[model samples]
Target chain A: SAVISQKPSRDICQRGTSLTIQCQVDSQVTMMFWYRQQPGQSLTLIATANQGSEATYESGFVIDKFPISRPNLTFSTLTVSNMSPEDSSIYLCSVERSINTGELFFGEGSRLTVL
Target chain B: DQQVKQNSPSLSVQEGRISILNCDYTNSMFDYFLWYKKYPAEGPTFLISISSIKDKNEDGRFTVFLNKSAKHLSLHIVPSQPGDSAVYFCAASKERDGNNRLAFGKGNQVVVIP
Candidate 1:
């Protein structure tokens, strides 16, 4: 199991502003992922953040809207750009312990509310 | 289309009894399934998982049963405790090119009364 932490557990932001959420892991992990969970809905994968390369965005998400930065193996950040009321949701970061096993550990999650 | 589905939105069970949570998937490509439990204001914690090759896996008070042909899986908790009350999520993934991505279903809220 991994100990993951996210900053700004809850926040309220004005529309058109951007919020950056940080994820820090206790140990180094190979793959890091970002997901969005709408209220009373299932989670949707936003992107896969690579340590030294650009993040891979999912089908419905684009980098322009959710820019990701992974400076190292134990840390990554996801920025919600140009926030709108519809963009309000809980953002979570997860990491796979090993490639052979598909177990994922997640952070506490950052809840963002746009006004 | 929702690849993973948890038909029941909520369930109530008495403490010290068995609690069962059900999930179904529409994608046959899913070769791995996992169950996660979450409390309000907290991230989900991994509970149990089963591979496509296995029909069942158990861990202490929790057991996961998988039926590949029916594309269904279930989580069972024995001697349920009030602390076990939380939202449970079912996730499925397909191994492709050495990489795996998960598809999650809407969670089911379980309330256990003592």
Candidate 2:
């Protein structure tokens, strides 16, 4: 299993403000995933970050709204731009532990609250 | 359009009893199913998994049963213990697709009574 760590385990922010969440993996991985879990909701993938290339955003998610940076294999950052109340959720980073099984190891998650 | 669904939001069971949680999926492409356990303020940890080729997979006290025809799967905890209380998430993915993507359910909260 891979060890993933995220900054700002929890945060409180005002509407219209932007916050950047950083994710660091203990080892290098080819790809890292970003997911959001809203209150009482399932985990939704925001984007897939690949090293040395642009991040791929999922449907209903855009680069302008959630800019992602994958500077290296072991590190990535996700920025929430002009966040609104609806953006309040727990953001998590994960890495695939096995390609055959598609098992993922997740970070502790960063809980964000917007006012 | 949630691909994975856990119809039950919560469940309570007495110690030494069996705790069963069910999940259904809408995507036939999903051939690999997994269950994750999450404690408060922590990320989900993989508990068990079953590939489409097999209908059941068992670990120490946890067992996962998969039904490819119905696109449904379940996790059973034998002799449930208080430490087993946590939110369980059902996730699915296509092993051959090579997409490395997993669709997860909302999660089921389980409580084990003493």
Candidate 3:
């Protein structure tokens, strides 16, 4: 298991503004994933961040809107640009422990609310 | 398409009883399945997992049963406690791609009453 932390545990932002959420892991991991959980909905993968490579965005998500940075294996950041009410959701960062089982360890999410 | 599905939105069980949470998936390609427990304002924590090769896996009071043929899996918590009350999520992933992307189901909120 890994200890993961996220900054801005909860935030209120104005529409059209941008907010960046930072994720830090205790141990270096190969693949890091970003997900969004809307109220009462299942999580949706936003992107996959790998060190020293471009972040892979999932369908319906674009890098222009949610730019991700993975400068190192232990750290990654997700920025929500030009925020809207729809962008208000819990953003989570996770890393897979084993490829064989696909078990994941997640960070306490950054909850964003756009006004 | 929703690859993973948890039909129950909420479940209430008495302490010391069995708490059964069911999940169904439409994708047969998934080889690994996991169950996660989440608390409000916190991230989900991995509870247990089962592989396609195994029918059941148990850890302490938690057990996971996988039925590959039916595309269904379930988590059984024996002697459920109030501390077990939380939202439980089921996730599935295929291992061939090495992508490790998990398809999650709508979580089930479990309330264990004393």
Off by over 4 Å in 2: none
* DockQ per candidate: 0.64, 0.72, 0.69
The residue-by-residue lDDT of candidate 2 on B31-113, one tens digit each, is 88889999999999989988889999999999999988898999999989999999999999886656367889999999999
**Could you tell me how far off, in angstroms, the CA of residue A7 lies in candidate 2 after the best superposition?**
0.8
Candidate 3 CAPRI classification by DockQ = medium
Between 1 and 3, whose TM-score is larger? 1
Work out the TM-score per prediction. Answer: 0.97, 0.97, 0.96
Which runs in model 3 stand beyond 4 Å of their true positions? none
- Model 2 lDDT tens row, A1-115: 7889999899999999999999999999998999999999999889999999999988899999999999999999999999999999999999988765668899999999999
Candidate no. 1 TM-score? 0.97
Least accurate 10 contiguous residues by lDDT in model 3 chain B: B93-102
Cα error, candidate 2, residue B14 (Å):
1.0
Between candidates 1 and 3, which one is better according to lDDT? 3
For candidate 2, give the lDDT: 0.93
Question: Cα lDDT of all candidates, in order?
Answer: 0.91, 0.93, 0.93
**What DockQ would you assign to candidate 2?**
0.72
State the lDDT of candidate 3 residue by residue for A1-98, as single tens digits.
89999998999999999999999999989889999999888989999999999999989999999999999989999999999999989999999866
Query: Which pairs of residues clash in candidate 3, taking residues 3 or more apart in a chain or in different chains?
Result: none
